[model samples]
Target: MHSYAAVLRTPHALSTFGAALLGRLSYGTVSLSLALSAKNASGSLAVAGTALALFGATSVVLSPVRAALVDRYGPRRALVPMAVVYAALLTVFALVTRDHPGAGTSAVTLGALAVCAGACTPPLGPTMRTLWSQLMPDRRMLQRAYSLDGVAEELLLVAGPLLVGVLVAYAEPAAGVAVSAALVLVGTVALALSPVPFPVRRGSGRRGSARRERTTRTRPRGLMQPVLAAAGVGLCLGGLDLLAIAFTERQHQPGAVAWVLAALSAGSAVGGLTYGAVSWRSAARPRLALICAALGVALAAAGLAPNVYALGAAAAVAGLFVAPALTTAYLIADEAAAPDARTQAGAWVNTALNAGISGGTALVGVLVGTLPLFLCFVLVAVPALVCAAVTLHGENHRKRH
Candidate 1:
């Protein structure tokens, strides 16, 4: 087992990672803040929902495009402008709600700003993962870095909402958006100024030719295994929220839903840290398959719990695989991609994950009302299990080849 301290001890690692996390925290806050602010300003839940949907759609769907631009232009040249525009739009959105003061702001106006803001959102998470790869060339150390990064991100997402909750209690919801804007702008600037250099993918160069050359060496399917695994994980997690609520409501202990969800987060953090400390001989893709399989099995069985507490325990156990699966997917993508295309590769994995989250919610929403609860759990777990089987089959096929 390796000490995580060593990963942070790498030159500029702490400062760089901190900056990236700061920016990512904004992501956590923005959704809740935007939704609340839009609701308050427009005096309509529909407007707020539409605003959130628009923002999430643009941000999640266009992740790879933003990452590709960073790969082509490097972080400072690309990320700086993106952060600037994103922060500016967030500020504008914040102002709209602040100035409106329940005057019933137009849904179209809020939705438009949200779309624009999301479109300019920087690809901080993918960039940070790529940076970790650059900072720690050794795969083992890189694994630790990814683990630490993942754990911190999980915490930040939890904390960002809490921070917004506090802010909204004291000030307006728009204040949360304002704070998110500051966090991203400052963090992006610091990251851009960091001494660590991001290798830019050029149109014509040996560096640029690497990904082009890979077409002859590996198939597109071969490169996308990690992304598929990530998508499955996200899909399971997305379904979990609705599933947990349904379980809690059925048991007539709806308040326990928060604790159940919290258990999942706590389990993921512990699992991520533990997974990071170990030195594994198995390859990342195979590890990913097993991780997904374990999570699927756990979740499939989670539907049978007799009580809310038992269901929470099941959720915690299922959560154990979540971080390890994601960490391995990132490791695989980083290893598979050329230096120039690494960010985009990571972004593809990210895009798949977000899309899966959305799909999972929609899928579960439709099924939860129609099917039995256990059957719903089984259905949600299907994606992970199917993804695992595909990954293992692909691995074995390559071995046979």
Candidate 2:
């Protein structure tokens, strides 16, 4: 609490944090809003699913490129225009889909528009993270800030969907989509306008500096490890979500799916708060490996759960380790990446996570129809265990050097 207060007391910290949270909320709402709009327009769950999938695909593909731009040009110069364009694209998508329901050309246009919107969506999360590194030079305070951000994200995952549902139910699906766009525009622009100083790349202005820096740089070690581990975590989380739905449906308690999933997020929030509050004595890499192993064990327990109640409980336990592992991954990435490439490295973390989620969802979607759902949980566990092993191996290899 003191740490949070101190960080927020820094210049523009509070405003930047608030704006970034709002921007993230907009991001969290996008998939649900798009799906609801697509379903309303096309009158088919299949089309809606396809639209959401395409949006995720495009966003994942373009995230690194967007981050590199932020690193090269600074966030204010890069993000503002992207946010505006993204917002406009989203508005057009909403208006077109709502007014021309079931029109073939409209559907096709919506698909293309979603892809463009995704590509244009500003990299709010990564930018805020980089901002934290700038604002809070203290390693402990930085960890707390990252953990707080992660907790807020979990809350967004819960609240964003509920807000969209309320708007869709009480008003219209288009209203929800429009609100999402508005939030994105407002939050991202405010963040860009905040007084926080964006980190400028070292030697950015010197002629031929980029080539010199590239040539002089030693091969970065553990650069990909953190990213791969992050992806593994994402895979487990994606599978866990689908497993919750399948579990609840099998029990004929489909309504409980939200509660079950909430258990995981709630646990992660609690864990993040606790982890950030304490000062850990261990190295970040080893801690990451330990947490991943614990998470994997918890997930396996979830797989063996005999009932929905048991499954939710196990999931909550698994969630306890999620934020710690992720925070450590970010710490590792910060240490390993070149000074000029930090923002891009952070962006790669998001990219890997998104890719993992997409792959996990697709893989589980295929298996859920033909195999036991418990096996899906087992499948999720595999990635975490692999992440642990890889991290541990990396640590050992580094120690030998």
Candidate 3:
């Protein structure tokens, strides 16, 4: 493992890592903050869920448009306004949601504002992946960079929510969102000033190619393919998130919710380290995804277990696949994107994945009042199996094509 000191020793690494850390921290704090805020405002899980869903759904819906702006105007130009807008919206959310736990009208308005703000901020995942593609010298080094990033992200998600929970317990629920906004503003400005803003490569060999060239461009489609797969994976993840929430609430220990979620995040950290150590030498990768499939199935079983320990054990298995699957998806996507569209392409995949998760959450949330928790597990597992099947199909398709 790279030490913190080693990562910070260079200006380039520090900038990239700082941007990634802040972005994840901003994103991770939303769930806990929204949940706490909504609960405080309306005294209902339903309202809290709505606020969270709005933020996610809005972000997904707006991502493509934001990407378009980035393509036309350049990321540096597009980033500033978006970041400012997102920060403003989050601040509004903090103030409005603080004093109105059950004010239906206020909550609804704040949710809308929050969602719009959330959507405007271009996803940092794609930008960071694009940075990885450009800044790193080689695959081995890039893999390490991404692996370290995965660890940092997991830590952010783990620590961010826990911090929010602690704040809610001692001070106020709204502090979480405020902190998120402050971090986003600070980190985004730093990213904008960094030398990595410029694209390392730009051209399209297929720009004016014949039909055959377009068909076999091996660029844009490769990028889109991961988005498709990531969306499917997102669906499963969305369900898992809702399952975790409902299950934790049922356990009468809502405060321990982060730990339950962290089980999966912890598993991802371990899996990322393992994946970084291996070399996947092709775009037609299925082995790692197959492992993810098995993990999802195991997670479903864990969700149905009679106790928390058994549940955690199952979650560990499920979590183990998280990083490897993501790593493979990203590697293939990067290999496939047009030079000019790399960041946009990566962001689209992320958008698709997150959209799928949000959609899953909405679908599963609807099922919460009707279905048993075990049944919900079954429902969530079905999509994960589908993701696995599609990944396997991609493997076969690679062979035949």
lDDT of 1: 0.91
Off by over 4 Å in 3: 1-11, 34-49, 97-108, 169-171, 200-220, 244-259, 281-284, 300-306, 365-379
Ranking by TM-score: 1, 2, 3
lDDT of 3 by residue, 291-393 (tens): 5577568767875777666676677778777776666667666667665566666677777777888788889989988988998887887766777777777
**Cα lDDT listed for each candidate:** 0.91, 0.83, 0.71
Quote each prediction's TM-score: 0.97, 0.94, 0.81
Q: Give the per-residue lDDT of model 2 (tens digit) for 251-334.
A: 899998888888898889989888998888899888899999999989977988888898888888999999888888887777
Give the number of the best model, judged by lDDT: 1
What is the overall TM-score of model 3 with all chains considered together?
0.81
Q: How high a TM-score does candidate 1 get?
A: 0.97
Question: Which 10 consecutive residues of model 2 have the lowest summed lDDT?
Answer: 212-221
Candidates ranked by lDDT? 1, 2, 3
